[model samples]
Target: MLLRQLEYLVALARERHFARAAEACHVSQPALSEGLRKLEDELKVLLVRRGRAYEGLTPEGERIVRRAQRLLADRDALREEATALRTGLSGTLRIGSVPTASGAVSLLTDPFCAAHPLASVQLRTDLRAEEVLRRVRDFEIDAGITYTPDSTEGVRTHPLYEERYVLLTGASEEPAAHPNVTRPNATRPNATWAEAAELPLCLLEPGMQGRRTLDEVFTGLGLAPRPRVETDSVASLFAHVRTGRWASVVPYAWLHVFGVPPGMRALPLVGPVHGAPIVLVLADRRPGPVMARALLEVARRTDAATVLERLP
Candidate 1:
């Protein structure tokens, strides 16, 4: 019935614990419980089904929680905009990103920070494309960076870059690393999909979006890469490849940021260049949040793909 009630509900849904939700709402357990009761009575519906401890929300509660999240986001955005008119934007700007694109999130956040000194940025790097979209829909994050999503119904997308994959391997024996790659020509340093498959590789978990794309490339070429290590962390992939015994297929952005790690080689994987378009996704709400709009503007003006043309 009240915004305070809605806040309590959203916090409960997020924390899934009565005491924690109360703590998040900055109120005592009794006050939060009383507010929820009044909200339920006014709506004449059982929002949460409880049994001593905190039980999950009811079906109706689930629907209301979604709407509550949006309403709260709008309320906060309204306040932010009014404040911005006088003092500039203040509040956290949340952005979610897929792991591969995580290294490059700075491409967006750096500029946003420079423009809005009163705001802070929270960059969540563990999201998958689905989770990013989901969080955006639920207003958990202001925007997302991911490979061009398959569906773009209620969201707006700005293409940041086309992700290019590269093979990261140790340079311990490079001038003649493989019979195929005698030396990496700076202008056209390349290795074929088949050549990459032949190496002892370390890769992301199969469940990851980037790993799936890599699998498709190998499958298309009639080659299957058997990685010696599998991890969810990109840093782990780089570390394994650093051992000289394992090679990895990673986004060229990593090379752009850290530059071939030391004693390593980053060769553009060709013979089939699989490129994925990474983008910024914002919810398509009417009069979207001011911070999100500003971020989208920054993204549109950015040449996020420019680094690919001139990287190690």
Candidate 2:
């Protein structure tokens, strides 16, 4: 019934193990379990499925957990509203961002923190589009940096910028590298998504939104890329490409943050596959006073033009 109980429940759901969840909440396992029991008793519903080990939440338990998450979010918003009214501003802001956009995460945080030095920021780099929406709805994260499939409901988006896919290859003229091509920009040995798909490629894991988009583009062209390697980290992807044998598809903006190695050249994916837009998404629900204003300020500064100009 109390917000603290709901907080414990959320942590438990995230961690899946009672002891670890309790540790995260800075409480003993017994205390955390007792709180959850009391919450179930108050609501008159079973909120957890207990066995020899933690199994999972019951159907009703799952429902309650979702509601509890929203309730806690509302509570935090109320407190933020009151505090902002009393003082100028001060509170924690949690941000979730897709792995690709993780590079640009600081673009919003740096300025926001500079203006409101008292506020704290919690950043989560490993996020999917659906996960971002769920956290934002539950008030877990204040906002997110994600790409568009525009599938998530109950969220508003602010366009950050469009991203063009680029090929990354090593510096040396290794024969192992794909043969050089004469495009408008032929100084670099590069190919379009269709062209690259013909050769061995390194790509992100399939589930990631970035990979999905790349796949869609490749599939649309009736081409299936043969990946020599796959991974979750952009750094690792570039590192592999730097070796000269592998090449990867990356957003142009990424080249700016993780600079292309001296031996590497980034050629834009042209011909059939152009690019896609990235966005900053936030919950449609009102935020706490301090966080609400801060969220708007972030959205204001991260407009399409600002981000586009920074793209490689």
lDDT scores in order: 0.86, 0.77
| Poorest 10 consecutive residues by lDDT, candidate 2 | 181-190
lDDT of 2 by residue, 158-245 (tens): 7777777787765554454446632223465446766677655789989988899899988888988778788888778888887767
* Per-residue lDDT over 187-220 for candidate 1, one digit per residue giving the tens place of the 0 to 100 score: 5568888878877778999988989988998998
True-structure Cα RMSD, model 2: 2.9
List where candidate 1 sits over 4 angstroms from the true fold. Answer: 174-188
Q: What is the C-alpha RMSD of each candidate to the true structure, in Å?
A: 2.8, 2.9
Off by over 4 Å in 2: 177-190, 287-289, 310-312
Top of the candidates by lDDT? 1
